[model samples]
Each structure stands twice: as C-alpha cells, then as structure tokens.
Target: MPQIMQMGEHAVIGLDGLEALLAGLKRRDYRLIGPTLRDQAIVYDDIGGTADLPQGFGDEQDGGRYRLVRRGDARLFGYAVGPQSWKHYLHPPMLSLWRAERHGQSFDIIESEEILPRFAFLGVRACELNAIALQDRVFLGDEYVDLHYRRRRDGAFIVAVNCSHAGGTCFCVSMKTGPKVAAGFDLALTEVLVGDAHSFVVEIGSAEGAELLAELPARKASAEDLAAAAAIVAGTAANMGRDMETEGLQDLLARNLDHKLWDDVAQRCLTCANCTMVCPTCFCTSVEDASDLAAETAERKRRWDSCFTMDFSHLPGGSVRNSAKSRYRQWMTHKLSTWFDQFGTSGCVGCGRCITWCPVGIDITEEVRAIRDDAPK
Candidate 1:
C-alpha cells in the first residue's frame, strides 16, 4: 500500500498514470512533444501517449559519438539529450518574414499569417530548462521582442524531468544549471524505480500544473519517496563525466584573444556549424530575399546562421574573421565571455550538445581548460 503524506504540493503517480497526464494535456488543446527514438537517436517529436516514448532504451553519448542502447526496462526518460533541442520548435531554422506582389506601379506587401502552435514539452531536463530561460532573455527580454518566439513561448507548457543519469559529455554540475531542477517548469517529475515497481514523484510548480495533477491518478508523496528522488539526483550530480572550471572564465577568455590554443583547435574543427545548430542558446540568424523569375513576386525569409561561416562575417571590406582560427576564437569568446556582457549570463547551459555532435570531438570544456592552462603565469 502507498502511504499518502501531504508535504506541500508533491505527489506520487504510478507509471501507468502518465497516460492520464498526457491525455489531459491534449484535451486542453496542447500539442505534446517529447523524446522518441528516431534515426537511432532519441529525438523530440509529437507524442500521443506512453507508447510513443523511447521505451526500454537509453543513450550512450561521448565526444563526437552518440548511440542508443537497451536498458532492459521501460524507462521513458532514461537517456540524455540528442542533436535536436527545444530551440528547433521555438525558434525554427527557417521562417518567412513577409511576401510582396507587384502591382501596376508598386509592390503591395502581404503580411505573414503564421500562427504559433501551443506546445507542452515533456521530459525536459533541468539543464534544458535553464537553456530555455536563457533563450527567454534573448528573444523576449530585448527592446524589440521576437513576435514569433514570444507567441510560441507564451503559450508553451514545460514539464521538466530531474536527471537520473548524466551523459559522458555532460557538465551541468560545473555550470550550476542541472542534475536537479530549481525552477522554470509547470510540472516536474523524478522517475523512481525499485525492484519491480515503477512510479514517479511529481511536484507541481504552477496552478495549471496543480489542476493537471488533480486530473491524474496520483496520491500525496511520502517522505521516503521524496528522499529517494533526492538521492537519485545527487548520484547523477556526483557522477558527472565532465567538469568546467568557471572561476574568472569571462576574464580568462577576454584576455586570451590572441591565444595559440585557438589555432590548435581550428586545425581540427571542420567549421561545420553543427555546434551552433545543436546548441540550445545560440540565436544567430541570417535574412534573405527571394524573387520570382518574372520579378512579380518576392518573399523575405530568415534562417538560422552561425559565426563559423565566412559569409556570416562578410562586411564592406571583406570577411572580418576570415581564418578558421579567428572564427573559432570569436565563437568561443562570444559564447563564454561577451555573452555575459550582452545577456548577463553565460550563453552555454553545460548541456554538452556541441561537444557530442561535433564531428571532430572538439570539447568546449577542454578548450577552456587549455586556454586557462596556457595563460601567462
């Protein structure tokens, strides 16, 4: 028998009750998006119920390598993040800004009629929540907010998951972002499995979450359940496979503008821009205008861009960061140092997507360590 102990707003639900939660969200007109196995990797996609989740599967991730493996149990969220981040849904790779049709003597502008969809993101990791918060500062905090991003973000519901396992490339412990969720979620869940029983300890973070929990088959969580959840998160934190020393990291990069370490990494870097694509906080984009052959119709589009591209630095004189060394340095410095000046926080969330997805296994933490080690003593 499960003991019902009321401690604040925490509750426990059987693993089977997860379907009820999903159903409630869908009934409320939310497009549920969660992790699913696709192309041999766990990627986010539309999920209708527990069947759509990556059951009995986990992921093994290291620098430049990611593979899915069987965990022998039906653990819905037993893996780490893959190449796709929530940014793909919120800030799409491509968007049509506007279109225009030629008139007799002028062109009439046609306004974009795109409607942002309401999404409920499930199985979001703690570090990913911080990444979303950081992106909120970028797209919603500026003087002129991104209308599209704001619309989508405003109606989105976040269901965060406290990590029970850490990837080999994960370094959220050093970034002070994860292993446990502190905030920025509607409902947070910690998967608990012992012996042959499986359940989840759910914590309500908002009124909407409380209402949703009421609709699910959950009971008040006991003290033992809460303690078990804490221990699981603690174990994950202690076993982080990577670490990043952030002491004076901002100044360290700023002073090493001419560091030779940049050249060393550039030789191995393919300038593929995979890091930026997989990064949850990278917000660079480029705009293009396309016209029909008859020049009667034209449309303006914006697509995700990266600083690693030579064309990204094209100016009146020429490309400023022409060499790969300069381009890599610019990207790293801006991500670690200049981002603080611009956003008041580190652009990176220590999710390690950049390291895992990079074709050359270029680790950001390793680069930072190399720079710090080679600095003038």
Candidate 2:
C-alpha cells in the first residue's frame, strides 16, 4: 500500500509512514536506494530500512564547497540534494558491453545488457528530477534510445523531495527547476515538520505512486496542514539566493566566441575536467578494448571520458581542440549555449555541482556574469 495518508483534509506522510512504504516496496522485490551519511558526505546507497536513511540531517555548502557539519536538529531528509545524483545509476562511469571470444576459426560475439536493479530512489530533489528528465530527452527521445539507459530509467521508482534548504551555490530558482517541484516525479514529498507533527505533504503523480501511498500508517490531513505545506514551499522558494539570466544568453555566448572572457577564464581553468565529471548532464564517453596477445578473446569497455582530456578530440594527425583554452571554450559553449541546438534544451540545470567541485573555485555563473556585464561592442 502507498504511504500517502491524510493529514486531516490534505495528504500527509510521516517518517515512519515513509519507511513503511519503502519496506513495502522492498517486499515486492524492489531494491531500495536512499541517502546515507558516508565518506563524510551524504551519498545514495542501497537501503535496508529507515535506519539506513539520514534523518534530520542537513548540509551547508560554499564555493569549492564543503558540507556543513550535521545540523543541531534531527530532521531526516532535511538537507538539499548532494553532489552525487541519479546519473551514476543511469549513466555509469564504466561498463562492459561485449566480449569477442574465439577458438580456432570459430568465433562468438557475446553481448549482454546491464540487468537493471529494481530500486526506489528515495529522496531525489526537485532539481534532480529536472536533470533526470533532461537526460531522458537526450537518451530516450525519438532520435536514439540508449538501451541501457532506457531499461534502467523506465521502471525505476522515484520518491522526490522538495528541498527545505538551498545550498549556497545552488541556482535552481534561476534555472527554473526547483524550490517547488511541479511535474515529472512519481511521488513528490514536501517535509512539513513545521511543528510537533513531523510529516510530509505527499502528492501522487502516477498510479504506481498512489498505490504505494495506500499501505502506510497515516491519517487524512486537515486544511491547516495543506496551508502549512504550501507555506513551506513558498518560504523555500523565497529563500533561493542565486539567480541567472538564461534568456538569449546562449546566443550571447555563441556570438562572442572570440570574447576576452574565454582567455581570462582559461587562465584560471586547469582543464582538470572536474566540472564535466561532476555535472549531472554532461554525457560524453569513450571506449577501450582489451585483448590477448594472440587475439583469441577480447572485451570492450566504455568509460566516461572528457573533452578536457588532450586525446578526446583526436583525429588522424592531432586533436581538434589541441589547446586548453579552446577546449574550455568548447565545453562552456556546448554546455551553456549550443547545447540547445544539439539537444533542444539547455545542458545545465544550475545544480552548481560544477561550481562546487572545480578545484580552483572557478564559478560558471561568475563567468557568465562577467560576459554579460562586459561593454557591448
């Protein structure tokens, strides 16, 4: 049964109620995954029970970000989304696609599809929901469907969160993906522990989600609870501190290809590629082949590779983007500007993972602002 219950007149879900829902799904052969404190940070992992979840936890972050110590108040799922996203599951860093085996003149081509694990992502944030949708448009759209990506994404259950706290670098409001989630989640949860009754305002977006909400220990919500939940969303949206102007900005950057901004940023940019690695939307990859000296058998492995790498854009003679400055321009332009042309959407969701993870604290928004504020020629 679904954990969604009534808070008098409005729907509500308590922590215990949510655990019950996860447990219910697990019993139905679903592999449950949720956030837990690990590696000194909150990371997504398989969940055994509610005990595995980071309850009453929140994090503070800054540029070249560091997570704040756990909060004084214990509110499980209080924190904003962390650097790790659902991308790891859908677009893994490395994967083996096929192995060519041969004996004498006879050979076999063995290709295997990644058997997707049935799991419930317990606390996907609003912005992450947008990120996931963006990837779907890229990987599952009309042109080409990534078989592995489709299999993993098609059936996975989503239990999304309405972020209670905004990270210092977060610009979801500017990106127009968050503060309040509107669509694309199976089950949306807004933590409404405004008083003694710690619970979530639950809304069902799919029948599967509605059915899950029915199994929990819950009561019908009152109008007051609904009002409180709305207030919470309102308050969170108002609190978003970072904003960006994406209107016509893509063409602005593309037109200004030779703009001095690229040279200035290249000075600080290490071409380390941490931004691409951490970015939830960047999906470039490279393949490697392993074989025996006799060429009897071999395997092909696909690994996440970056354009920042000197070899990524290589041709017969040399790499097209042979310089760090040119590579940086390519990455930023593709990400911020031309991505619309290639994907029909912006590649960045403004999660700020790139800003936070870059070793030298190079902020993309800062660069955009410098470009925007530069004198018009």
Candidate 3:
C-alpha cells in the first residue's frame, strides 16, 4: 500500500520497503548489524531483515529499572538503548595482543590478526553517535592509535534514527545530543505512523546512501510528510525525562574536591564498576601475560578495567585510591570535570545507560543536583 508520488534526492518509503534496504546493503557485501530482541532485552546483533528487528516491542526504563513491554504497533525503531552499545562491536571486551611459541632455544612471537567485517549499523540514536565520536578521540586522535579500533570504525556505515519516543531515563535533549540527528550518519530516518499509515522519511547524508536509495522503490517526500516528521522530532525534544545543569559544572566539580557530597554518594555506591562498564565513553583497560607450566608458550591479553578496582590505582608503594569515597570522587570528577582537559568534551552523552543498568539505581543527575544544591552560596 505504498504510494510513489515523485522522484528526487530525498524520498519516503513504506514499512515494507525496509527489506529492500537490507537486501541492497547485503548486495554491496556489507554485514547488517541492527537491534533485535534477545534474552528479554533489545540488543544490537547481526540481523537479516525487518523480521529480525524488534517490531511491536518497546521498553520502559528508569533509575535501576528496565522492562520490555508491548507497544501495540509494529514500530521498528520504538525502543531506547539496552545494556549493550556499539562499543562492544568496535572495542572488544577481551583482545589477545600476541602469542609466543618456543622454537628450540629462542621463541617466535606471533601477532594477533583479525578479519574486520564491513558493518552497516541500523537504528543508531543521536546520543550514541556522539559517544562514538568521543571514543574516536580516545582511540584514534593521537599518534599511538589502536589499529584494531581504527579498522572497524573506518569501515562501518551508520544509519541514524531520529527518536520519536523518549525513555523514562532519557536526557539526550539536555545534553544537546539527541531528538534530532545533526551529523555522523550516512542516512537518517524518522518513523511516521499516522492513521494506520506507517512510513518513513529518509534523508541521505552520503553518496553511498544515495546510491542505496536509488536501488530501492521510493518516492520523493511530499510537504505533508516532511511536516509530520518535523513535528515528531519537535514533540520528542519537548518531553525530555531528565535534565542536567551543565553550566559551570566543570569548575564546580574541580573546586568541590573535598565536598561532603562525595561521602553521601560513596555510602550508596557499591564500587562494583557497573557505571564504568556500561558507560560508552570510559576507555580504561588492563594488560596481562599468561604462560604455560612448561613456559613453552605465552600470550599477552588486554581487557577492560575500571577505576573502582583497588589495583587500578596501584603505585610503587600501594594503591592511591584506598576508600570508596576517593574512588567515587575520582570517577565523577574525571567524567564531568577533568575529561574536558583531556578530551575537550564531557565523558557522558546523556544516554542514561548508567542510570538504567545500575544495580542500586544510583542516578548521576540526582547526585549532581545534590552537589549543586549544597554548594557555598
């Protein structure tokens, strides 16, 4: 029941046309990775077509609470983020650096080489895009770039989705990273469902996207279709679930190093490193060497680590951050304040993953509000 009105650069496609898009990407030798329902949660994984998407499914998210619910409509991109992010795909949790094998007296070092896949990411949100950009600075900005991360990032294609429904913990609007995608996408889509008519307004952001669209059955978008898409984005922007006061936040944390707010947060924090693990911007890691009993072979491996661990701050004498209060203080200060000195931007993207996935439901926004309220007047 799709109508083809005209022909142009921008177009509108019915929900059924999604398969054509997926097929087009596959024909180009790109592996399509998208959102799907797995283990009672929406996760990013390899998908085949529209049938693999989490259709008619939505999620309810709040501080330390998350539940999957029926949306009553077959909306493809209706849910917010789950526990997983694109980070799991780009930067692996455990990476083998190299292996050594004994050949007579000397040992031969064998480097770890992996075959990087060409991936096309579907349903990428605006805040997630910002997170990926921030990670780019961490892995590829300097001379000592991570070759593995660079290969995956450079070959991946992004298809961003403009949010129409905001989650209970969502605050991307306050961080100016969401509701409407500004950049970092090959193609952007806004889902528009009105009166039993489900369609999408697609905007091409790259030559590759344009070529792909040309291969699909689509029509030039009309004025009414454009208006409907704009209104959906506007309404989503107006209904933000939480807000963070970023004005002078950097200086506030830097000056309040000895503030009592740290103690209050430490009492509730488990120091379990859930925040750092779920965080899309945290890049801390640890390396280790493993060898056999005969010492005939050895392997070097790198894995994700967190500041909450005692050994994370190990020095010549002892660990620097001994108490939970000191560890919590260091984490918050680095994320909101000192991160600017190191990366020129805040470490948080307002994605609310940390707030939703925390075991005790410790809200970062609430913590910041408490500190701001108790500051010297």
Evaluated with TM-score, which candidate comes out highest?
Answer: 1
- Across residues 1-377, which tens digit of lDDT does each residue of candidate 3 receive? 24322222457888767789888888878889999999999999999999999988999999989999999887889888888888988887899889999988999999999877798999999999999999999999988899888988986888889998898888888788988888888888999987699888998878778777777778888898889999999998888778899899999998899999898888998999998988888889999999999999999999999999999999999999999999989998899999999989998889898899888998989888888999985
lDDT of 2 at 41: 80
Each candidate's lDDT (Cα)? 0.90, 0.80, 0.88
What lDDT tens digits, residue by residue, belong to model 1 across residues 1-377? Answer: 14333323799898667889899999999999999989999999999899999978998888899988999777788888888999999999999989999988898999888866689999999889999999999898879899988877987888889998899999999999998998888899999988788999998888788878887888888899999999999999998979999999999999989888988998999999999999999999999999999999999999999999999999999999898899888888998999999999999889999999999899999999999998996
Quote each prediction's TM-score. Answer: 0.97, 0.94, 0.96
lDDT of 3 at 169: 85
Provide the RMSD of all predictions against the true structure, rounded to 1 decimal. 2.1, 2.5, 2.6
- Off-target runs (Cα >4 Å) in candidate 1 are 1-8
Instruction: Report residue 91 deviation for candidate 2 (angstroms).
Output: 1.2
Better of 1 and 3 by lDDT: 1
Evaluate model 2: give its TM-score: 0.94
Return the candidate ranking by TM-score, descending. 1, 3, 2
Pairs that collide, model 3 = none
lDDT winner among the candidates? 1
